[model samples]
Target: MDEDSSERRWEDMELDILVRIFKTFNIIELTSGISRVCSTWRLACSEPMLWKTLDLGLLKSNYIKIPAAPYVWVSDSSDKRLMRLLKVALGLSRGTITCLIFHYDLYLKDEHLIYTAERCPRLKQLVLPAWNQITKGGICKAIRIWQDLESMTMPSIVHPPYIMEEIGKSCKNFTELKLMGPCDVLFASTLATWLPKLKVLSLRCTVLTKEALILILDSMMHLEVLNISHCVLREVPEPPAPKRVLLELDETIIGKASRLREFYTCLEDSCLMSQRTKADEGLIRWYKYEEWLWRMDEVSSLSVAMEQHVEVGGGGSIVPS
Candidate 1:
């Protein structure tokens, strides 16, 4: 080894400069790399501040051989090793780690959850896909420890009563919430009542009936924005009213185009009532494609003739452009 060249390497990166370099790596990676460069480097890498924000997703593929899907993740020894590694990672720098993202399956045991709750006492934001994994008791326990929790994005929350009453009641500063997938009238209404101070609520691809929708709207009157995008809606069957109405409120408000200021389904089904023409007995052709368009054009003309602008029933607000 060239002593002169080796000594010169310290000019660019002294002990402090090397600690800064070591801080960029994760707890596991930094420990291994620094341990190789004699005992002194190992001591420097063990600095608690160097190991904040432990991202378990980064170590998903290589260390654990964990699959993206739950069904595919092999419940073998390697998986146990991965969980142990997570625990060790958490243990190494609990005080320093303010942010921890596990972009993988949370098939964690109860002890693990308790350990995690203990370690990440000040965890402010959490994003977990399977809320079912964490029970109402577990949630309450975690929140009891973590008073600083501000944001959470969980999918398919089964225990709303516990979360709304217990956890939310405890966490005074809690603001943002994003619950994804199917949620019924009961759950949504409960949330509106519980989280009165909630600023942002995102029901991801969740379906809501018109009646259920109204209940929510009335409850969350302070709501600034609402997103029901990509959500399903089952049409409510109603007794046929007058010959026609101007516009359908339900259709316009939730469905169809973006410029929808006022929403209702009034224009009628263009397909069912379409004109069918028969030129001769022998020819099986009904109406030409262009002929149907012409018929719709006539319907539009008739609708226009009835009312240049139809006033909504019960003196409701007029339609917007």
Candidate 2:
């Protein structure tokens, strides 16, 4: 009876404390190390709340570099390991995953995504930077299953209409979107038509067209936040130059967007950190500077600067446009 009393007393410790301790673990240690220590630890590890935000960012450490490629590729061994880790993480999640972030270097296959989608039906926010191998059909199938999805950060695909349409139809709460590539006229128009209720949009460090910018500002009535920092705007020449010119957002656009809770334009030309040159296009890989890329101030900044319309103050707070 004494031994039974001791075990019960140990188990009586606050569950919140146990969860706090478990949160310190990396994916590998949480899955393969602490989970197997004892039933109590295993139970703690399997807590649904603990698995809500499954950040696979550390998986980048296991990525194998491929020669002559700008992005590193995951090896067969790494893929198998990742699959196992994902299985363990999702199983522990018990279908309660809401936010998932993948590393830029990790190449996810269709099967991997399908497996995740099948389990994480409650997922709301997904950040996937690399989609080199994921086909349209594969992603669409997953998106269809993700009925509750709200926010997503995705790679730039040439054709985004079908995916946008799919999300518009299925995800009623879908609002926030961040595109990591060129937001051209067609893409912007598609978004404006399909996702009229979109609230937050980030087009940072991409090729943004002037027409597309105008369309988004004019059409998306529900927009509350906009980020167009470091974007190379499509030139608006008299006859239209073949090469797109970097643009400065005029007052009209700023005035419209500034009505929102937050509006992020661009930084001054003198600010080396904010100025993105044409040559720098696709040159700075996210993985190389993932820490800086994901910094809270930089990632979530709604600060702005334009020719004279808007400026982001030192503290990243918004000054009047």
Candidate 3:
């Protein structure tokens, strides 16, 4: 190397130039070591622009299936590791985070949710696909904290009224929702009652009843976009009769949905996603199928982006800036 080039130090670079360079690094790379190089680099790492969207889509919990209520036993080491990572990320973010994304397999506990809620006061969007360990109270508390929340992607719960009520009361700006499980009549009714003004909804790859679909279309007057792609639409019958699966939407449904700006549906037998949904009996067994399919959504805003993986030392622990 030339003497002049060797004499120049990275620390002498302008902060704006360093921040622009850091912007290209992924979450793992940013939290791994670049910040520790110098005080100036550390300042660049803490810049609000770099922390606005904290996407932990690649991080998943280490757990084993159990035959109990929770159905999975997450190791203490795994929980601690997640907590440590959250501490480092949230600490550097300094309450500037607006969007947060989590992997569908990353089962988070109440403490983790609460810790994140307390830090990300300005959070506007969240995509948390797994909620096996999260309790109703824990979710309500988080909702209360995230009053500015506008969009979410979550799994369906057993009883939906309580959470819907909480969201209605707290997140006035909330308009978009994506469900990763069946949407029964009760769930649809609860949404109509609480979030009637919801603008965008995605019930992709789930069981959706004909009555529920109609109710949503009729009730959500302000709905602008709806996605029922790859859904197993069914009609429940009276006593002594079995539910019948629907192959196509009748004129009634088509006419009502025509008013929406964007309505997505795929029920063709040749469609791979539709076949998968039927084979899995409405609830998709994501682990048994293609990984990308589970994260794909008809609504572009709800789709998960493909991220690059990077290997680091210290058992992959995320180091703070």
The C-alpha RMSD in Å for every predicted model, in order, reads 18.8, 9.6, 3.1
lDDT of 3 by residue, 1-321 (tens): 866666658988888899899988887667667866888888888999898889877543233333443355667777786787788788878999999987777788999999999999999999988888899999899999999999999998889999889989999999999999999999999999999989999999999999999999999999999999999999987868999999999999999999999999999999999999999899887766654566688899888775654433224444442
TM-score of each: 0.60, 0.83, 0.91
- The candidate scoring highest on lDDT is 3
How much lDDT does each candidate structure score? 0.48, 0.72, 0.86
lDDT of 2 by residue, 223-276 (tens): 888887766777555565575665477777777777788777674566443554
Tell me the spans in candidate 2 whose CA falls farther than 4 Å from its real position. Answer: 1-16, 66-71, 236-240, 276-279, 282-284, 290-321
Candidate 1 Cα lDDT to native:
0.48
- Please say which candidate is ahead in TM-score: 1 or 3: 3
**Model 1 lDDT tens row, 1-321:** 766654455324566777787766554555334444665665565566666555543332332222232233334554455556655566556456655544323354445556677887877765544434455667677778777777665555555676777656777877766554455667777777787666555552344445545555566655544444323333334666332212234544443323322212222334232112112211112122321221121212111111111222232311111
Q: Which ten residues in a row have the lowest lDDT in candidate 3?
A: 60-69
RMSD of 2: 9.6
Worst 10 residues of 1 by lDDT: 299-308
lDDT of 1 at 96: 64
